[model samples]
Target: MTQHRKRDKNLGLAELVAIALGGMVGGGIFTILGISVSMIGNLTPIAIIIGGLIASLAAYSYVKLGLYYKDEGATYSFFKRTYPKSHFSAAAIGWFIIFGYISTLALYAYTFSSYAISSTEFANDIQIRKMIAIGVIGIFTLINVLSVKGMGKIEDLMVYTKLVILTIIAVVLIQHGSTSFEGFIGDMAMDAKNSSTLSILIVASITFVAYEGFQLVINAVSEMTNPDKNIPRAIYSAIGLAVLIYVVISMGALFAIPSEDIIKNKEFALAAGAGDVLGKMGTDLVILGAILATSSAISGTVFGSSRQMSVVAKDGYLPKWLAIRKKNIPINSIVGMGVMAAILILIGGLELILEFGSITFLLVSLLMAIANYKLRDKTNSSKVLTTFSILGLAIGGVLILYYEFTAKWEQMLAIVVLYAVLALGAWIYSKKNERAKKIT
Candidate 1:
């Protein structure tokens, strides 16, 4: 068989940033902010800002690695190329990258389903909610299969939508406050029941989920117009903008809902916050924004992960059949990802998927950090930041993982599944490497 090679032309800066922002600011932030406020009181915004900074540092590292290598594997290729010392580590990073993509596809699939069903009482009448969710995945999957341009346009528009909604709410809360939600932070002075050091850290770890989506840009690097310059600029700009918006929205959410009500009703925290003063219209818009944000997230994830699948296919890790062309794109794997995402949606537990996805990203990020330092190439700016960012991310990851895993035994199973994927990828890569050596 002839060697197959076809690459997506570069996408513009707007498309790149849209992808990053759309992927990062999903439904979790709206919901997670509520949960964070309830637990940390007035410091909910502070906790979110902390998580945002940690996530941004990780984003900065990804930007650097993506620029340095400019390869399709994104973080996977970065680690594998940078550190040849341990093949196991390379495989681990690859597996984790794949896991993060798939898990996000799953996480946001659930979000879309919830929103689609909430539009109609009958939609949730049966187990139909899950079915609806799967249906939404199928549609987006088809879109991706058709063309990459369409997906990029859709993602970019969604990014603007999310920014507008969040911005409006922030303005409302910041300027004219009709309702005094001061009690939301009444516990700010370290009340023993809620202010335990353990609880705050636990909340930060949970908040991390709200902040980890910007790396989606690298997955589309092949389609990006200027990988060397655009990738770095777009990725960093997206992270900076998202961090600012998230902190403001988190603070607004804290001010809108009483801490007690926020804890009691985590479902529509942002809407409630909006409702406190602005009444029904404000709450409704926020809910609508949440729906749009989550939908865009699911769309971006399916689009990006499927592209990664195409990249792995080009590299010969996945079957060459996936690398074959249909309308100048990878149709088979894109549809396959859609099907996988739909199934994951049927699994129907957002919390489980979010934690699993976040942990998976952290694992890959930890590897990238180690790879940067081990490479010891300080002359390169990307590597330099990767070194420091990866280290900071690891400390944060460890703290959060310990806090999260200690409580949920189910998480151990996620880790097990995670490692299993790593082992499998490593074995496959070794086989391929051997075949290549023999051919030479």
Candidate 2:
């Protein structure tokens, strides 16, 4: 208890929201912008809003469970504790959530690499982008392994600075608009006239990945004060702010740039669009914003996900070595996640990994909704909303899978293979621990 209290002394509401925003506003918006705009045109902001609503539905359960469990393990801990008898349940959720984080890690690092090279000769070089992604992951992993306090302070600076930069970039793009706001609206109406509602929902489902990191707040429960009040406040506030930022940025991009450019330079779409519309200054600002956003995201993710990985390992859901810590920092887990993310960067492209991350989080959050609904009385979770959350996320998860199957079947196959491997490893450890317990 004293140790836990000591940890909490270093964090407050500001740090907590910073972590949540850092985890969220990373590569998601940058990557999703091109895809969303390509498919939905000017209605991209609507998709982002729908995405945020889905995120809030997901957050409803997480906040309730976080207040009740207050465990650093977060998703894994909440589910495992709620169903203590189910080893498979614990193992699967642990594997899924950890890998989900890895996928987002890959997503953010890839986006960072993309913007980092948008102006260079190497902008189209896949190999160079992968190398840069691995390098950024290495840098953030080291930062996380060094000191928790140091990581928190750096995250605060990164998150706040990026917010300012992004806001400025949005305003500049809006001010330098190539098309009138009314013209953009007319284009959206035409686009919507030809598009189906299902397509819009599918895009929203894909964009849900942009809101993925808000749960990083729950992982910091042990390091926060007033868990009950602050957990909800921070998570809700972060998600709300993320939605607004995403919409404004999308609107700015659409008003200033053509949809064709957004899709053609999809990897570094925003920076490319800004360069064309606002020239070098606009391009540089967008690049800087992307750098800060992805940098803070990588740092916050390494900080929170590593701790959660440590907790899963402690429960025998993963290799015991991953649980090893120094000065309360999950050094081994941080290195492990970084290494895996780097491997993913080498193996998968941005869109493939982005979809996988979205699907994994949707499933995990759906599970969280189920868990919260089961313990609704204890957690004071609203039965109606929790049920809706479950249904919403379930639909979101299925929609992404359906989108992948219809559009990118190969990526879907790879995701399935990846899940199989994770499940097999989880099952082995789970069974091993259970049998050892019986023998003892």
Instruction: Choose the strongest candidate by TM-score.
Output: 2
In model 1, what lDDT does residue 143 have? Answer: 73
Q: Which stretches of model 2 miss by more than 4 angstroms? A: 1-8
Error of 2 at 167 (Å): 1.0
Provide backbone clash counts, one per model. Answer: 6, 0
Instruction: Report model 2's TM-score to 2 decimal places.
Output: 0.98
Predicted candidate 2: what Cα RMSD to the true structure?
Answer: 1.4
Model 1 stretches astray by more than 4 angstroms: 1-10, 84-88, 119-126, 173-187, 190-193, 272-279, 376-379, 382-387, 414-418, 421-440
Best by lDDT: 2
Residue range 39-131, candidate 2, lDDT tens digits: 888889989999999999999999998888888899999999999999987999999999999999999999999999989999989999999
lDDT: worst 10-residue window of model 2 = 1-10
Clashes of 2: 0
Q: Rate the local accuracy (lDDT) of all candidates.
A: 0.68, 0.91
The true-versus-predicted C-alpha distance at residue 313 of model 1, in Å, is 3.4
Q: Which residue pairs of candidate 1 clash?
A: 10-223, 10-224, 10-225, 11-223, 11-224, 11-225
